[model samples]
Target: MTQLAIDVPENIFSTLRLPPAEFAREMRIAAAVQWYAEQRVSQEKAAEIAGQSRIEFIDELRRRRIPAIQLDLDELEAELNDG
Candidate 1:
């Protein structure tokens, strides 16, 4: 695993009420979620990046009100018409 170091303001930890380790974890999860939402990464890849299991990542998506399936209206319509 590659390790990354970021410089954050000291006060940010207190402001967010998160310690450095927890804050790093949250940052990872947030970045993974954003990438997943943007269609830049698959759910499996995003889960791996977030250090979460697939099921846990799906639950996180649900909690954040993000759709797990990335189907658009055209795809939905086509499926409906095919059925």
Candidate 2:
């Protein structure tokens, strides 16, 4: 595993009520979620990047109100028509 170090303002911890370690974890999850939402990565890859299991990642997506499936209107319509 690769480790990354970033500099954050000291007050950010107090402001967010999160310790450094927790902040780092949250940052990773947030980045993974954003990438997943943007369709830049698959759910499995995002989950790996977030250091979470697939089910946990799905729960995270639910918490963030992001759709787990990426189907658009056209896809939905096609599926409905096919059925």
> Which candidate ranks first by lDDT, i.e. highest?
2
lDDT per model, in order? 0.96, 0.97
Q: Write the per-residue lDDT of candidate 2 for residues 8-35, one digit (tens) a residue.
A: 9999999999998999999999999999
Stretches of candidate 1 exceeding 4 Å from the true structure? 78-83
| Model 2 backbone overlap count | 0
Pairs of residues clashing in candidate 2: none
Q: Across residues 3-50, which tens digit of lDDT does each residue of candidate 1 receive?
A: 998899999999999999999999999999999999999999999999
When summed lDDT is taken over every stretch of 10 residues in candidate 2, the lowest stretch is: 1-10
Best by TM-score: 1
For all predicted structures, in order, the TM-scores are 0.89, 0.88
Model 2 lDDT, full chain set: 0.97
State candidate 1's TM-score.
0.89
Note the residue pairs that clash in candidate 1.
none
